[model samples]
Target: MENSASNNILDFLIHLDPFDQLPRDIVATLASTASVKYLAKGESISFHAFCEQRYLYIIRKGAIEQRTPLNKLRARLGEEDQFGFTFLAPLRDSEDGYRAEAIDDTLLYLIPHEHILDLCEQHPELHDYFAATAKTRLDSAVRSIVKKEDKGLFFRSVGEVASENIAVAKHTDSIMTVAATMCGKQKSSCAVIVTQGEVVGLVTDRDMTQQVVAKGIDIHLPVHHVMTTNPILINSEDKVIQAISLMLQYNIRCLPVVSDHKVVGLLTTTHLVHNHRTQSLFLIEKIKYANSISALAALREEKQVIFQALVESGVSAEIHGQVMSMIMDAFTRRIIQLTEELLGPPPCEYAWMVAGSHARNEVHMLSDQDSGLVLDDNASEDDRVYFAQFATRVCNGLAAIGYPLCSGKYMAATPKWNQKVSRWKDYYSKWVASPEYNKLLSISVFMEVRSVYGKSELVDNLQEHLHQTITASPRFLSALTRDAIETSPPLGIFNSLVLEKGGQNSNTLNIKKFALNLIIDLARIYCLSAGGSLTGTEERFQYAVKHGTLSQASCDNIIGAYRFITQVRFKHQLNALTQGNEANNNIRPDEFSSFERKHLKEAFKIISELQDVAKLKFVQGP
Candidate 1:
């Protein structure tokens, strides 16, 4: 029985890819160090503690109950079930280790800690997997258990609390009279212009100023002449965020809120701005006022508050992504400007490129700095030196302004990432033309690149050329689609949550990589394949819809998946930031209510479905 149990443990370790990378001697050492153990029902394996050393414990028979802080919930582990060492291998506090309690009489092999340490010391890559897996598990746990405010944060439907005493004007009313009523009564920006109490036209200060005052139209002109016809309006039951988006998209200050085709109320920029419950006004202000390094740095520090407020206010995930992106862009540009000031002007024409999250404009509270540069084709050695110096300074300055340097140095200073436009085009052509492993990765990275400063045309030209290159190469798109499919959300059979094996977050979800990135990657591949330049995931979906590449229902599903995943991530980060914890994408299950847990599970299910469809569509057989 003992020898059979030992073989089972060895089989389990063999199944884990990490062991396959080890030398035979190391594997033998691990096998010798390991001990087969048996636990009866109610046995406490972890004692609510992480294994001091990395322990690969695999259940040979019976079951192990993984207990949550909330006593009512327990995850059952059956045959071949493994749980241990979530954070023990160079563990960070961010990760959670497993705590195992036996559910039935169970047999297990406790792999020796010394062997684990020795193997990790020999193979840093193996150690890294442990750390990454730990982090991923921790992030997942945070997602599963984190608490969100019960009240609809930002976009609570405006049906009840919304002011229904809306003033309306006829399209024939004089512009001056309408303006007088608005200014005189200190009323919200616009009144619903109704024809027999049915919304026909809406007038606001922006419309009045742009159409009447700016155009020097007579004030005595009828409101019908000045009022915006076919104005963007919202349902009274709609979220205030929907109203805000309508306003921002059209540059309108007010929108008529109609119900059952009857004017019920008016939603104004002022109402949204003043009503603390309506939106994250401070976040908008921060993004608006952040024009310099100091301001940006200040905003970065206050990002937590802004994020929390925004999530609580019910800001739509799409708008939230954009707002965060815009603010990060502002900060990044300011850092680049400050760096330029410190280093003086470059010797030649060059464009600073925002790489990664900033490039995609999907920055979160703890977004890292991912950027590079591109010089003109005809640059001298002296010019290259200057560009390099400027990029180094810019990266350093950015590090100071909250964007930490990437460990891999995927920055402007790196020659691989920074090059002349001609060189960049050559690289793109080589990648698409051949599509090797390194080249495919390069293209994937390039998908997120955008111009932050300097010659935007260079970056724009590169984008156009890359679009042509990718469109010309079907293999490149297929490879990208395969890459995208690799890190899918871990929604298990029966649509249950698949928790990480070992770590502080042993049973959590990685919302960013698994959830958010799935949508992001899908959008990216589809957009690039379709010759679309839209960056934001939601925007890409919309673009696809507009171009007839995807159905409206498909677009809605993608958008819904994105929103559900992002909202949870944002809320998790908000909680961490508020609690003085570093902002991260991992979430624990205990932090969530049962209802939220069900919702999160459903969201991941949607993501998984989308991924399967995308994979089927994009990836071809060998």
Candidate 2:
């Protein structure tokens, strides 16, 4: 190729992914060695391990359609779309033979496989882009986005932010001595007590005040008596996000940071709050300490700001949802406590459960309340009335704090959903035993209930009953599978009526209704069919793979698709918020770059393929 022509090719390559992620000089090298081919309409190229030529094909100006050896259509590729990733790998890893035929006169640039192999060797990060799996490509895409953003301290190792001033004491140390150590030059708020060089317990300033001063216990007593034994510890090498997750999960204020089972430092809520990068991420702590519903409501704007930060930070969707869900959980729990305080404690035992997206821990900006109440079976009529008012206040308070009330009334505030244990079991029994089509919608909302507050055992009992009843019913999964496949991802972007009117001429894509929910619903069917009780969509699919119900490859493909779709939705919503518009699921088509449009089509295809497989696998079963 001439120098000017090579430069033009380099320009196009640099604008594409993987190449765009590469250094310009390297991309220029690839471009200089690239070959261009023009395929007339109806002309084709066949790919297989045995083929002498293996090159990554980039469609420059036209459309192409890939077909399997069985002559079934594989994918439709447009300009900026690339194919033949499987051919870039070793022969043993290549996909089955496929043919790519030109649907229009196509101008294609072919990057020699050997050159890409050399590129991968030089830049190991680029390897994922050439892997035969969508999972690899999607993972690489996420990493690329995160690498571009201002990664927050959440991405840093816990050791970086931990205080090395942790007071080290022996298990046999007296309470008075440990307290003295905490107040010494170290000025530590916590102490790690060890026995035989192993961490055995943890003590904090609160323990000293509460155990010794408040109770006037013997100051000379061994610290072990008042210390929290078998205390939770975090690895120094783990990311700050893991530390945050641990603190939230166990409701702890401090963690002993260990290296090779040796106490190295201490981390506390105080340490986290003092850091600017992570201060705003702890809105859950604020929610917990809020004095009233008004105070919690005031923090709602802060929640949005934290959400924007999370999106900008380019964290994975799972972590993003987990953080948001934790915030929601805090809000709900605090609201329930305030409601109980005002209305007086419940007359009977109960569990406050969340359903749908919240239950799955997939809460986003648009998520609303999908909750229920399971009361103790022996409650009286008057007890029911008191509990009814209690739940109403909690639900309304949640609404006041930015969690909208469920439009479908799948909430504890609804009398039909707030019932005794026996009634809840009966509802599950009726839905599972008969497996009627219309009844599935209501049951599906509560398909994965998680006890957010109160007695968790009550919720566990209901989950066991529901799972057991589902196992006994033969047609329930088939019904769920049928319902799942009722909607298909668009064969093309707009095929599923995925587009809503953006204006007089442009159209917007309803990403949730058309995309995210499809994956969520499929995950539920797969997990429930396997008798697995996992709730999160990604984990449920992995559970399916673990139990031999789904292939690992399929699991990877689906999860990768789910993650990509979620990123699209979140980034779009984040963009909307930044632009002062209401964050929503509807995204305009023109907003997508060539890169996004191409990957989105791949994601849509994966969902469509999985839906087909589910229909055949579950709906066809006896």
The whole-model lDDT of each prediction reads: 0.66, 0.85
Top of the candidates by TM-score: 2
TM-score, model 1 to reference: 0.59
Give lDDT: candidate 1, residue 541: 79
At residue 311, candidate 2 shows an lDDT of: 75
lDDT of 2 by residue, 1-622 (tens): 3498788899999988768877898899999988899999999999888877889898888888777787756677777788888888788887789899997899999989899889999998778877777778876666655555377777888999999998999989999999999999899999999999999999999989988899999989998999999999999999888898788767888999999999999999999888765677777778888889999999998888878777777777888889889889999999999888888878989999999989998888889999999999998999999988988999999999899999889999999999999999999999987767767888889998999898999999999999999998868888888887776665443322232122122276777877888999999988987889999999999999999889999998888888888887888888888899898888777787766776787787788788878988889555
Off by over 4 Å in 2: 1-8, 21-29, 70-72, 491-506
Q: How far out, in Å, is residue 354 in model 2? A: 0.7
Clashes of each: 35, 0
Q: For candidate 1, lDDT tens digit of each residue in 507-620?
A: 655668767777888888777656798777778878877776666766665676567667767777777877888877766656754334534544564565566667777888
Native-vs-model 1 lDDT?
0.66
